[model samples]
Target: MYLTATLDEMTEAQLLDHADEVSRTQRKCEAQVLRIAAQTAVLNSPETIDPDVARLPGRERVVRFGGVGTPDVAEFAAAALGARLEISSGSARSLMADALDLMIRLPQLWRRVEALEVKASYARFVARRTRNLTPDQASYVDERVAEPADGRIPWSRFEDLVAGLVVASDPEAAAEAEQASAQQQVARPTRSTEDGMRGFFIRAPVPVVALLDGRVQWIADVLRSLGDTDGVEERRVKAVAVLADPHRAVALIEEFAQWRDGSGERPDVDWSSVMPAITLHVHTYAGPEPTDTVRVEGHGPVTGEWVRRHLGPHARFTIRPVLDIAGQAPVDAYEIPERHRQAVHLMTPADTFPWGVSTTRHHQIDHTVPYRRDGTTGQSRVGNYGPMSAFHHRLKTHGKWQVHQPVPGIYFWRDPYGATYVVDHSGTRRLPAPEPPSPAERAVARALFGLAA
Candidate 1:
């Protein structure tokens, strides 16, 4: 009886190992059957490849069926399918190779599933053994396995639900609706560049009339065009020009009196306030050069020399196409700060440890690489500290530590998804977080802990 039982156990293990191979064979068979059905459908109908003959067995069948044979229909009948056939030798060999490849890969897939099961079991064991977890950690484990609360869903399912609703209401319009939905998915959220530029304006050597009202508008249009174009990764451009000052123009007019045949005074337009005051001498950069140089010919060559000469002692201002210059300072002297201020974001409650085991807490802080020891102040700002719990701090202080092979989760759980939730107990359910001091449950828990709200 013992020998028989041992043999049965070995057989069961063998079957389990080869389960994936069996599944692969099943899928291959299903695919072949589908292909055969499709091929057969093409050969066995009035809509056959020739499209001429409708009846099989040709003239005799047409007479037997009491239908007159059309010439087109007769031609279709001639090519009718006679028998179900097997795939050719070359095709069969190729299919066999694919199946064999799948069979060879079975071990890898099996190993992955086995690994996942083993890891999950280990976590369960640890959770059950370690009874000191905080309320928060226990709740998190429960939340993960429970049905999603508040109907919140992952993105894939959200999209599927939207499509199903659209399809159910208007079946005929489904294709167009789906296409429109796809387009919406591809479009990024629209933000007004104008909002980021409330205080700024670009002053080119060109007229404020030209630069602000006209040239700036043209630049925005160009950026829109760039966004629509395929294969353009990123782009930057600078414009410069040599503009004649209002005073120098009189002498320039005397130099070219012949051209002064403007017939009469054609209204002296205020070029000072209307047009920009500085001259552009040169500009240079190593980025996407304009594809159509002709479009920009009216403006100066935009060379580096032009930029330096007209824009003053490289201190007054800087200019770039498609960029707002208002919130910015003059380019010659201004440098972007090396440090920037950012808002301190709150951590998700889902991740916060509960009942604070100092070891686990310290582990998290150390793992997160929070504030390093500064050698002077015993305390550091939270920003400087890696995200670790108070628990981990205790361990490092008390235990003989392994600097190289330190306990995991010292600073933070590096990859939250990487940690497995072990079963602490065999299918035990946990209650939800108690409602705020409703003058009832909160009072009870607090009373037990000997505290007051």
Candidate 2:
């Protein structure tokens, strides 16, 4: 009876078609195995190994034993022998202590610091933010914290110092600071010299070093020529180009410059500080148009031309702008590429109410599920407090700011192009898609997995 039923099912054609599909999948898998084996044979020979690979000592031995199960004592020892340095503080106190330290060590860090006034100001900032401090941590506020000394490093300078002492000195470690000062200094307008061009800085985001396709050595050469200002210049310097995801673009230029040590390797630069964070939307235009201009109450009237010129043609080529203000373009302002506009929007206020926008206001457009948390809000904002992609709203009833929420990851989309993603507790890596799930895909996954019927 069982044999007869099986034969009948196969006869139905639909069931047979499913079986054929399974068979085809199995055959493809087998063919892939065969191809992999053939390639392995051809590629494995000593003659086929590149000269550089052959020259490496114990190259074959290392490759053969490369696994967590097989402990390579030599490799383990090599990694373990690297240097380690400790800084004192709780996670809460550390940022304060470290920031103060950076200011002391590298006063050039912040653009301005009145000798007495800024010192008191930063000390107060540190004191107010710290929570649940131990006695030692508390002492960092009142006792350990020293007033800014004459010519002592400011916030930016202190960041550079730590990058040098902590990151530059160690090969295995990653260094991070809130500011990159050297690049900003290089960007300063200066007198034209013998080089046919006045000095200009090319500070890229620090993470770009690992991301670019070209040789790291070539990058180092570029960095070395940047001069002591930590910037490199070409025959003609145009705009000081800065391309980085918002907020995550924190790191000082001196830290970036440190990649060129005795080894002479050029390091990627950080462009964050060079592009100052925006407080309010300023419109730019070729000329002022009546509807395209919006006067940000305290800021006077900002025209579309104002926004356009500041963005420049480079970013506008890719990012089209949308006027978040309800009525008009405010002035003869055209939309920039949506992506570039969002880049500006992420760090500034774009999604807030019409009357609420201003450059002087302090607010960061925050991701609801921060890129640090694995949430699906793309770099673009779509709806109002819709579980993701929340913007800064000044009103109390509008709801809480998104930055306050915890997430598995947080990311910023660059454009329709690739996304700049920062995984929770990991170094930032740019991926093709900011988040993995689409709404349609999510709905399918939910049904398939018996998650939501």
Candidate 3:
């Protein structure tokens, strides 16, 4: 008997080789199991067995008579396989059905699987997909798929190839199938989950889904332009809210028309109330120009092209230097300045909590050391300030969660359960690194260069 080597004793290359061998073995075992199930199905087929054919006592030959039908065989097989494989009876039954389908409908595909030339899962997938296909059409699909010159084909590509072949081989059948599918399209009733959340499901045509997605994205883009720097999920919810309200819908359409035609009066909408101030960060040393890369507050790093396209000519620009304060003593200021607030927003654009729920505009400037607990207000200094979502700020303030800023943008957070985590631009991480400069820095650098010329 061959002894298996321990993982600790194996080299990296050896471990990889062992993994491939194990995968091949597993595939072979799966193929063998499926083949056995198929064989058992045939053996118990009523058409293949005869009850009156058996003879006893000095008979030249004796054969077993009529066995159980397919239903009885399936039940026995499911029960036995379920017990042996430690799977549910329904799964076992499904597996047996797929195996029989492969054996009877796509024999060549089944043979390739049995020989381990094709994976069992792939064979099962082919079997299920070709159920609607005639034997000839299935054979054609099997011939195209089974023996790829370039080893195993990827599942996604395989699916596409099968779909294309199916449509090309029988367009009328495909059309009928599509018509049947359209008839099945429906919007399911809203249901409540075990959790507090409610779920709604819709099964519609692809074009309808695409239109809905485009509309949502348009609303989200508008919100972002107005300084509503919420996450994608929040923006989507806001889009839905706008769509549900007839007043907001009309306002949005009017704004869109005015922007498009440049003829209508400016809408009396107060964007300042709805929008948050966005700060963009850029690193001067990274590239010769500011447009090389840009970072948006409440959003992570974006390309220079994105900055130029999104910010455009109408957006305002401001330039400021990074604050430098060297002292252990806290500053006396209770209220943070606008410039300090912007700096804090630039440093930690999004919420500095693990959940990253809100944008910097919505976040509160939290003192690393609470003032009531002898913590300094570290005035106008980036090191003293951190932006936290309202929820997380309350948790730290009253729920006994401790947060410390060892560096300007890097924060260390300790939960009530004693687990410590590092929070920064990339959300929660195990290690700390310097935060990149905001887009405002890049904008300033670009303007200064333009003026000097």
Instruction: Please provide TM-scores, in order, for all candidate models, with all chains considered together.
Output: 0.17, 0.17, 0.50
lDDT by residue (tens digit), candidate 2, 252-294: 2344455435445545554454222333333333334223433
Using lDDT as the measure, which candidate wins? 3
Question: TM-score winner among the candidates?
Answer: 3
lDDT, model 1: 0.30
Q: Candidate 2, residue 394: CA error in Å?
A: 12
As for candidate 3, its clashing pairs are 50-66, 51-66, 280-438, 280-439, 280-440, 281-437, 281-438, 281-439, 282-438
Model 1 spans with C-alpha error above 4 angstroms: 1-12, 45-453
Span of 10 residues, lowest total lDDT, candidate 2:
65-74
Q: Candidates' lDDT values, in order?
A: 0.30, 0.33, 0.62
lDDT of candidate 3 over 1-453, digit per residue (tens): 113778898876567557767878898799888877666656555444333442444422322211111233423445577677788877776677778767766777777787777778877777767766776777776776666411233444455446655554565676556557658777765766856766657776444454466677777877676668899889987887897797986687567546755776866555453333433444322434222334443233334444454454435666555544332244467677776776677577667765454553767888776655345445436687878777878888899888888887878887665556777554454332346556787677778776321
Worst 10 residues of 3 by lDDT: 61-70
Per candidate, the number of residue pairs that clash is 60, 62, 9
> Candidate 1 on 1-453: residue-level lDDT in tens?
233344356555454435534554554554454334333333333443332333334432221111111111222222322222355543432332222221222223213223332122222222232122233333332233222211233233323323332232333344443335434422133444674532223333432223434433333334444342422222112111101243444333332332334545444444344333433322233445321111011242222332334334433445544222222221111111212000011121111232121211112333222233444442222222223245544443444222221222222221121221211111111223234567776688788997766
